[model samples]
Target: MGMSVGPSGGGGGRRRGGSRAPMAEINVTPFVDVMLVLLIIFMVTAPLLVAGVPIDLPDSRANALEQEKEPVQISLDAEGQAFIDDAQVSMDDLPAQLEALRKQRGEDNGDAPQVMLRADRSLDYGKVMLVMGELNRAGLNRVSLVTTGSSDRP
Candidate 1:
């Protein structure tokens, strides 16, 4: 309740004039919770800020790729379905489709487009290599494998 300019105690007590107000003491658990949630969101999305589309990369002992721009990532899911960027591309149509994408990417003027393959750990190497061959044939020689960082616990 706000105090009015009057005797508050209902007696002969006078109100203090322009005295400094008492500091408020309040619980801070909600503030801490909100801060923690923001921290979690930042951590979860930080890695995704990197180049290219997001993919669940397979773990490997090989060294990581160091580049400024994200490559055109290709994913081979558990069922061996092929995805260029985020869109599914049939195996038979991959070379022609990639050629079209390369042209659209201004490879005729700008730097050549690239391909990066992310295969399921259980997937056969032959299929991945076959896709590599197709990418090579399509003149996308910058093809490489995507993998989780060695320091990553997952």
Candidate 2:
């Protein structure tokens, strides 16, 4: 005599007629986890990437200027010492160095390159002005004074 088994009575839950198909849907859980980890790493490192010579910038309420290209950075410390990018430069050599930089930027024909001046808050206004004068004499007229935002004030 032949006997029939019910649906739940089972041959290890296998169907009698057909085999199961492979899963076709993608598993996004691992991809999302990796992406989140990469995002966290970037968030932690982004600020450190904006490295430059440290200087306490003066506070200002002036609106920030729009920039099209990377500007030449000039920094003056509280001791009135000057720096072009990160290298120390003497006041005597500043103008000549700036002129060389201008020429390198191909500003000789037209459209002068911008110079961003960052001066310590403790520096004298005259010292900053002198640097600005040197920059102007070098024909780098497109100058922007870098200052910290005044949002921290009450």
Candidate 3:
């Protein structure tokens, strides 16, 4: 009888040389799963990112303006109550408050700070015009009216 000796014991022991090397390839299944979960979370929350006072905007067929800076938002509810950046303020205090805000914004380029007016769809035209006049008087000449886009029907 001949006896053979090797690195592994030859007495009914399992061979180890045929074993596979530790897997060097990255497992992307968990990574892909985490990415998909993050994508779903962002998709679910994207619409809720636009924060502002809720009011029904009038429909218009106007081109949207290109925004350069954050404009001061002024909202008027259906009851004619005024709000500046979601904070309620009396009509009498609006101009001074707006002027202070403009000064704080450092409007020194000969261009007035832009103000976005968001009035309820049911608000009276006169009330809107009056607010416009107030904004103009506050030295905020670059006033833009915010409205929802609508398609014209024949």
lDDT of each: 0.75, 0.86, 0.84
Local error of candidate 1 at 8, Å?
A: 34
Q: What residue pairs are clashing in model 3?
A: none
Model 3 poorest ten-residue lDDT run: 6-15
CA RMSD of each candidate after superposition: 8.1, 6.9, 5.8
Q: Global lDDT for candidate 3? A: 0.84
Q: Estimate each model's TM-score.
A: 0.60, 0.76, 0.77
Q: Give a tens-digit lDDT track for model 2, residues 1-154.
A: 5455757465465665557766799999999999999999999999987636778887887878888788888999989999988899999999899899888884556777888999999999999999999998888898898999865565
Which one is best on lDDT? 2
Query: In what order do the candidates fall by lDDT, top score first?
Result: 2, 3, 1
Instruction: Record all residue pairs in model 1 with backbone atoms less than 3 Å apart, i.e. clashing.
Output: none
> Deviation in angstroms for 83 in model 2?
1.9
Residue lDDT tens for model 1, 1-154: 7445555544434546644566698879999999999999999999987645444666667786677665787888767788888888898888898788767764555656767778877778888888888877777777788788674554
Flag the better candidate by lDDT, 1 or 2.
2
Cα lDDT, model 2, residue 67 = 83
